[model samples]
Target chain A: MQKDFLELIRRASCELPADVIRVIKQGRNAEANGSPSRSALDDVIENCDLASRTSRPICQDTGTNIWYVYHPRSVSQMALTRDILAATRKATRLAYLRPNAVDSITGKNSGDNTGPGAPVIHFHEWSRKSLVADLLLKGGGSENVSAQYSLPNGAIGAGRDLEGIRRCVVDAVFNAQGKGCGPGIIGVGVGGDRATSMIEAKEQLFRLVNDKNPDPVLAKLEKTLHAQCNELGIGPMGFGGLTTVMGVKIGARHRLPASFFVSIAYLCWAARRASVSIVGGVATYSQISQQALKYKLPAVAARKGR
Target chain B: MIRIELPVSEKDVRKLKVGDEISLHGTIVTARDAAHKLMVEEWPKFVEPLLKNGAIYHCGPVMKKTGKSWKAVAAGPTTSIREEPYEAAVMDHYKVRFIIGKGGMGPKTLKACKDVGAVYLHAIGGAAPLLADTVVRTKAVHLLDELGVPEAFWEFEVDGFKGIVTMDSHGKSLHSALLRKSKKKRDAIIGI
Candidate 1:
């Protein structure tokens, strides 16, 4: 039962997601002048089409294997984390993924995307029947832009509101402008301590790129924030383009003020990951891709800079 | 718009303003993070010769080996900002005059672009498959074992490879201008 799920992730790691695939295709409107945009879109799509055929990553940055586990039953006795790691090992091998984790100081490659910080698996306990895992293979190009603000020490603004949060998201993307390869989306973590905030920021990516915030206030804030981010003109690949924020996924954690840690994790569209679920010991998957996970991007393509 | 080969000099690059587009015909080498680091470390031995006649493209293509032949299905320009730190040194070491990739180069690369008669060409990001069509031939390769295809040196014989002049030898950058312009419009609408 577990082997099939593990095998699914192995295939997912190398495969581009549908949403990301859409963004990769839509980001190419820059060449609207002629076939450059269309041509580039065709090229990327060809790569995507061949991704499964070639069993190769659509983009080079295969990223870290992150598992967001939502447990169904409060009384569930499954070895939650152990099971995830077991599956991670299998996926890593099948994907032929390059080792992206190792000693930050020694700078040695782990050779298989595994290490102490290799696959960051997070679990949330809930009551239900099946276990659901939102897998994300976060690439380094986007991950390198992660920013942390230890509220009491680093934050410059007082009375944290939508503006303050917006600024943080802006500043993060701005500082990352042309570097983290914007116009990428910034995952904003509002309401939590430093540790909790970091995790929340990452989980926010699971939200659909185009879905609107259910909360009216939050939705307005998100729209405003996204528009400002695009204004940064850190175009396609940060060279300057219309679509910057595919969508901003926000996550919150309840914590005291003193425990507050505001963190922002930026995600480039190349973010890749996928997963399947084990139901009644039978397996089913959403078949969502880590790449081509086009958030709310109006344009559904990302073109290569000619 | 007619695509013509333009040989721009450093002095000419200094005069470029924002939003001017141009197409170039010449030799360019593909390299990303790892290869850039390697070239910086090795300096003369690895970079000098080809750089004299070429440009450096920041790209990593999705490749595959089928029946003893290597083919690129999607070869797109990666983020160029990651190479900012090493670009100036590499450009100076190799005396390069052009850079082609997605995302514009950084201040250091920008400065080098101005000083060395170079231009940072912006390729449409995420169009790897389309760009692959432009690469008529992969004439040779280097350092494949160490870094693999996406990060290896793929000397291509290309015809009419297209890109926008986001950052030119004339010190004009479309990215910065767009950011500044859009930021104001957004601020007004948001009233922030």
Candidate 2:
């Protein structure tokens, strides 16, 4: 199981999901010929190709490992954390991940990629007899651009309704400009406390790029935000062209009466994430994009041996 | 597009203008936040000869050990704005000719570039593997133990590394212009 988990980290780091690749391709096609945006997208596609072929990390900043785990009550959290930490160290040795966990106060790095709160794991217990783990490698550049907005603000004329959310999201994207690596995706959390709102926004990134929102109003807002963000002409790396944003995903949670926070998590085009479910000791890998599974799964053979 | 090789000459760096595409060859050094601070504060005399009139890349590469040697797996540019506080001083002290990074720098760094005959080159931020392919060999490493892998000073012999000149030695900055333009667009979008 540890080896399988290590392989999951390798896959998530080296190969991007199909949905992200699809949207990036669309972004490339949308750009004008001879524009910097087209050239930038070309470089990204080439980088992805090289990373997948060589099984190397897609980006130098392999980023912080954020794991979402769903397991049965039988599985101990301590054991899960231990296995994850071990896998992380192994992954760092393999160069599948960069050592990113740094001590905040001392400004020192934990060279093995494990620190006090590194590889943040969110575990949820389920009734099913299966254990599933999902990993998202959120890079620093995109993470830096993420913003949280308080509603009923006069700036941008934002009010408490959905229109206010739209204004805030757009402003966030605009302010990000090309810094977050545009032709990017936006994950928006409409209602929650400060911490939960940010978490919810980040969670929205786990969804497939083209997946429709379950709620009609949210779906419409997603579509509108997607179009408007692209219209900003921030383009790829802010060189200026069409297709600034590829997708806009929105998720909402009930908020307290006093707080109305809208948090936005800007995800770069890399968007590396992968999942695996172990049911009855049979590990089955689930990709973020269902349409395409082009990369060869090295772990499938390991699972077969089990 | 212009093809420039390192260690870049001051004359060549001055000739570069904003918005010109560039491809670099020869040796360049990688440094980020920690390294920048170290260079500015400690001012390592041992590295001065190697860095003089050379390019400094704002990158924390993914490196793998191959026996005694190291290889770059993914080497991409980091956001340069974070190094704003220390960059001008380091550029002035070291006589660094080229600053290779992504997302651009601020006014102080731009002024230093103009004053010291240096230029800021913008690379594609997430194109790590592609950039790594351009690295021919790892030359040397310094401060690895103290600053960690990403923040360590890694010298590499590169071939045909591509970037756009967003800040020039001639008091021109494409990034600043773009920022102004984008602000106007944003104001119009918000109906301000």
Candidate 3:
């Protein structure tokens, strides 16, 4: 189980799924030939190719480890955490991940990429017998541009409704310019307190890029925001071209009457993510954005695999 | 388009204009948050020789040890704005001619570049593998034990390393110009 999980990290670091590659190709084709934006996208495509081929990290930062795990009630969180930390340490040694976690005040790296609150794991109990774990490697550059807004932002004149939400989202993309490494993906959380809102925002990124929001209203907003953001001409790496955002995924939760928060988590084009399913000591690996049907389950003996 | 070689000459840096595409050759040094802070405070004596009239890239590269040497697996430009506070002082101290990074710098770094005849080059962020291909060799690394992999100062011999002159020695800044233009457009769209 540990070895399979480590392989998932290695794969996520190196290979961007087919869906992300598809959108990037679409953005590249939309650009005019010989334009700087086109050239920038060309480099991005080349980078993806090389990273995947060489089984190297797609970006240097390699980012914070975020794991979303849905497991049967029988599974132990303590065991999972232990295995995750071990896998992370092994990954760091293999150069599949950078040594990212640091002491906030002392400016010390944990070296093994394990420390207090590193490899953040969100575990959910499920009725099913199997366990599913999804990993998102959110790099630092795009993470830096993520923003949260309080309602009635006087600067942008954003009121506390969907219309205001649209304005705020557009403004966030605009302000990001070439910084969050656009053409980027935006995950938005419409409600909740500050921390929950940000978590929900990041959680939305787990959705496939091409997937529609399950809720119709949010779906419409997502579609509208995607179009409007691309209109900003931020293009790839903010070189100014046709595409700024590759996709926008919005998720919502109930908020307190006093608070209305909109949090945005911007993901770069690398968009590295993968998932694994463990059932009865057999493990099957898959990528999130790639069409699930396309992957044939490669089962490994969970105990002996490690 | 321009071709630049490091340690870049003041005359060559002066010739670079805002918005010019450039391909760099020779050697460049990589530094991010930790290395920058250390460089400013300690002003490492060894770095002065390497940085003088040369470029400092804002990068934390993904490196692998291959046999006796290290190799840059992925080396992309990090966001440069974070180093804005120390950049001007470092530029002055080292006589560094080019600052290579992404996301541009602020008024302080721009002023420093103009004053010191340096330029801020914008490489495509997230194109680490593409950039790594240009690195012919990992020349050396400093502060590795203290700073760790991403924060360490890595020197590399590069060929055909491409970037854009976003902030030039002449005081023009393409990043600033783009920000202004984009803000106007954004305001119009949002009715701000």
Candidate 4:
């Protein structure tokens, strides 16, 4: 179990999922020829390929370790948590993960990445007699730009409606500029309290880039926001080009009438997350097809000045 | 692309513009949040010799120890804006000619770039392994015991460490200009 979990962590840290690479390539094609944004995207793609090939981390920050595990009722959650923690420690030592957990009050880093709340794990019991694990290595640079807004946000003139949510989303992306590391993917949560809304926003990031939102209203909003964001011209790395956001995902939950909260989770182009399932002692991964992993240089030398 | 050998001068960086692509060869130092704060507070003289007319990378690297020496496995730029508070002071005090980071810095740092005769080089933010491949040698480390691995100052001998000059010595900033244009677009879309 520890070994399997370690591989999961390694994959999450080192590789960009196929869907992410596809959208990034699409963004690259959409940008003007010989633009700096296109060059930046080329460097990004090359970096992902190198990281995946060498089994090295995609980004040095390696981010906060977030795990979502689903298993049968027979399995003990405690034992599962213990194994996950153990795997996290070993991964850090092997340099598959970085020591990122720091003490808030004392300003000390827990060198092995296992302090009080390091490697946050969410456990659930499902009826199926199988186990599934997902890991997200959310880098700190993008995470710092994540925002939460309480509606009737007079500052932005946002009210408690879908329009208000759209306003908040725009404001978030605009504020992020290139800081969130554009071309970014945004996950938005609507209609929940503060905390759960943020969680829902982050959970939306686990969905594939090509997946459509099942909610009709959200689907339309996602489409509009995706287009609206790109029009901002933040481009790749905020160099002011066509593509600022590659994708926008919206998720909503029930909320009280008195409070309406919207949360935006910004993910960089890296978008490092992976999942695996185990049934009958056999494992299957959310695979990255080989063709999607191929690398080529941009038409103009990306490293050369425009 | 412009090739700059280290131990640079104000004149070398002054030639860079907001959109110039450049590469650095020779020794560069890594410092992040804690190290920046410490450097500003203590004004450590030891690192001054290394940083004088040289580059300081805003990076928290992933390193592996091989036998007795260290190897940078994945060293990429962290967000530069986080160090906005101390960056201007660090540059002016240490004579740092290049600030290598991503996401760009704020007004004070931009002013300091002009006043201090420095430039802000925006690295490819998440291109960790490719950037790490440019690190020819991990020369030494400092503050390992106090600041831990990621926050420690790492001295590296590099070849072809590439970036775009987003903020240059002529009082121009690509990031600020982008933000102003982007804000106008956002206002139009949001209608507020």
Candidate 5:
């Protein structure tokens, strides 16, 4: 199981999921042939291919190692956590992950990627026989640009309603610009406390980029915000082109009347994440976008005579 | 694709303007939050020679130890904004010619680019593996024991390392321009 966990980290670190690759290619195609946006996406596609082929990390940052684990009653949470930490340390030693955990108070690195709260894990007991773990490597660059807004704020003229939610998200994207690494996938959370709002927002990122929300209202908001963000002309890397974002995912939770918090998680084009499930000693990894791995942009392929 | 060698002349960098795509070939140094802070706070003299007319990349790379030396696995630009407070001072003190990073710097850094004859080259953030391939060799390392691998000053010889001139010596910034344009659009959408 630990070996399977290590492989999960490797795959998540080195490979861009297929859907992310597809949207990036779409973003590139939307730009002019010689535009900077197109060229940036070209570099991204090339980087994806190189990282996966070499089994190197997709980005040097490697990001916060977040884990969402689900297991049956047969498994022990303590043992699972111990194994995960051991695997994280091993991954860092292998260069699959950079040593990211820092001691905030002491201003010292843990040397390994583990500290008091590092490699944050949330475990849930499930009725299923299989044990599942999903990992997300949320890069610091994108995390820096993520925003949260409290409603009834006069700054953006937002109130505690859906209209206010739209305003908050749009404002966050605008402020992020290219700094969040444009052509971003936005995950929005509405109607929770500040902390839970953020978690809910980040959780939305675990969904496939093209997946629609079960709630029609939230889905509609997602579609609307998606188009609105791209219309800002931020483009890829904020170079000014047709595409600014590849997807917008929104999730909502019931909140107290006194507080309406909206949190935005801006995931970069890298979007490093993967999942694995083990049942009866047999482990299965989620399928990465193999089609994306082999894809070469037409213009680039033509120039290189591939 | 404008190509410039590292240790570039101010005259060559002056010719670069906003929106110009560039490829740098030569020695470049990696420095992020901790390094930048140290550069400004302590005014490290050792880095002056390397940074003078040379480039500083805002990066924290995944590196593997190969015997006594190190090899970069994934080296990509990090967000440059966090270094905003310390950048201008470092650029002025070191006479650094190029700052390769993502996102953009603040107004002081923009002003310092003109005053110090530097330009902010915006590398594609998250495009690490491809960028790492450009590294010819890891030349040397400093402050490794103090700052750890990610925040240490890693010197590398690179060929065809690429970025866009988002901020130039002429007092222009592609980032600010995009921000202004995007702000208006955001206001319109939010009805603010």
Candidate 6:
């Protein structure tokens, strides 16, 4: 309750990580100067950096976050919801993110980054003392293409196999092409109720690119998914280039085997947002907004090709 | 660099080829998703006065305030294919002869361009700050209060609005041709 939601929002909005900044700049420079001025591999890194520092959003579409609060109890859920939104608006404004919300039916702009029933916050409680709120700052480009299919056991026979997920992700991103501001990251949520699987798919984003899933099988899926997504050749900004997905992440849960949903949530390179002060009564939490990341952007030109 | 005029004849548009960059001047209509939907379905009667073989820029500008006036900052072209469903109708209905946007439109729009003597130009994406420089002045801005500046029609006095020819009246598209050529390179990299 003590966490200042407004301050948290401001922090989340205005700032982003140096690495993210570095990559977005990389993308912008790649575009401005690509061989029409450039090369594919170099452009990918450049766009990621340009998106970060040009202070222009990595892509103009700085997406909506589908926040999931896996709370230990109901006591803090109210503040939990309030805190994240406050943080979302603040971080969005500061990041120089574009205002992207609009009424789907009426075509009226929401004016702020928010509107009615927006930033859908789903809460679940347990006896544990801590609160962990995971946010997926879902961008419109990729989100437009998020696919969920309730495959018959035969369709995805192994509960979840690498090929199906690969096809799903690659096809998903490929379909997005220039729409999702490509060179996106796709998260696959497997083995849950339809909605939960979708929710968990987004959670994988909090884990960062190239991070391994504790489950070794899921880890393999991530690697394979990452490789295949690139194979689509959607490329950076869909200019017949390479390095489409920086990585693919999967979040899995063991659910009743009778029913399963392969929920895939897509995130563009500009995966923006911050989490500060996940609380449990007297216990406190700090934050992980990209801007708060205390590392310098690595020069990966030499490493990019290899 | 090619220079094209409005209401170009099919023979003239067909003379242009993909990869030939051009600077276009003269009257062009501006529209995106909202304006596109209206024009395709049934645009307002007032809109009739606006269309004259004009260019449709797939943009929604982020504006800034200048000393005494307001100016667009980042006005780069957005992906134009999103308007594919309504593109042909808008082209034929309003006689929109040119489409300037990033990425390219699909087959139907390409066909319409060829039949209607139009061309789809591919401007560089993410070059908004630079692209914003070509816009010299805007005349008779409409719908600023209704659909916001972005969805509104901003007729401009542009000089050297640079764009690459993606699709021409002969039904050619650089975006597709680039993909086919690159796919072989991508496939060759496979195998040990």
lDDT of 3 by residue, A184-235 (tens): 9999998999999999889888766776665688889999999888877677
For candidate 2, lDDT tens digit of each residue in A1-306? 787789889999999887688779888998888877799999999899899999999999998788988889999989998999999999999999999999999999988889898988998998988888888999999999899999888978988999889889889999888888777889999888999999989888877777777678998999988888877778898888888888898889999998899999999888989888888878777664211122122343224421
Write model 5 residue lDDT over A112-220, tens digit each, in one string: 8999989989898999998888888999889999999988889999998899999998888888888888789999988888999999898888777766666788889
For every model shown, the clashing-pair count is 54, 0, 2, 0, 1, 42
Tens digits of lDDT, candidate 1, A28-105: 654454433344344456766766666655555556777767667652435766566566665445543444565566
Q: Rank the candidates by DockQ, best first.
A: 4, 5, 2, 3, 6, 1
Candidates, ranked, lDDT: 4, 5, 2, 3, 1, 6
Q: In model 3, how well does chain A match by TM-score?
A: 0.93
* Per-prediction DockQ: 0.24, 0.74, 0.73, 0.83, 0.82, 0.24
| Model 6 alpha-carbon drift over 4 Å, by segment | A1-58, A66-99, A122-136, A153-160, A274-306, B1-15, B21-30, B45-51, B64-69, B123-140, B148-150, B154-164, B174-192
What's the distance in Å from true for residue B15, model 4? 0.9
At residue B71, candidate 5 shows an lDDT of: 94
Candidate 5 residue A84 Cα shift, in angstroms, is 0.6
Q: Give the Å shift of residue A285 in candidate 4.
A: 1.4
DockQ of 6: 0.24
TM-score of each: 0.75, 0.95, 0.94, 0.95, 0.95, 0.73
Off by over 4 Å in 2: A289-306
Query: What local lDDT does model 3 show for residue A101?
Result: 92
lDDT score of residue B190 within candidate 4: 93
List the candidate 5 regions with Cα displacement exceeding 4 Å: A287-306
Summarize candidate 4's per-residue lDDT along A1-306 as a digit string, tens digits.
Answer: 888888988999898987788889988888888778989999999999999999999999898787888899999999998999899999999999988999999889999999898888888888998898888878888899999999899988899999999999999999999988878889998878888999888887777666676667888999999999988989999888888988888888899988899999999888888777788777667632111122222222223211
- Alpha-carbon lDDT, every model: 0.63, 0.87, 0.86, 0.88, 0.88, 0.60
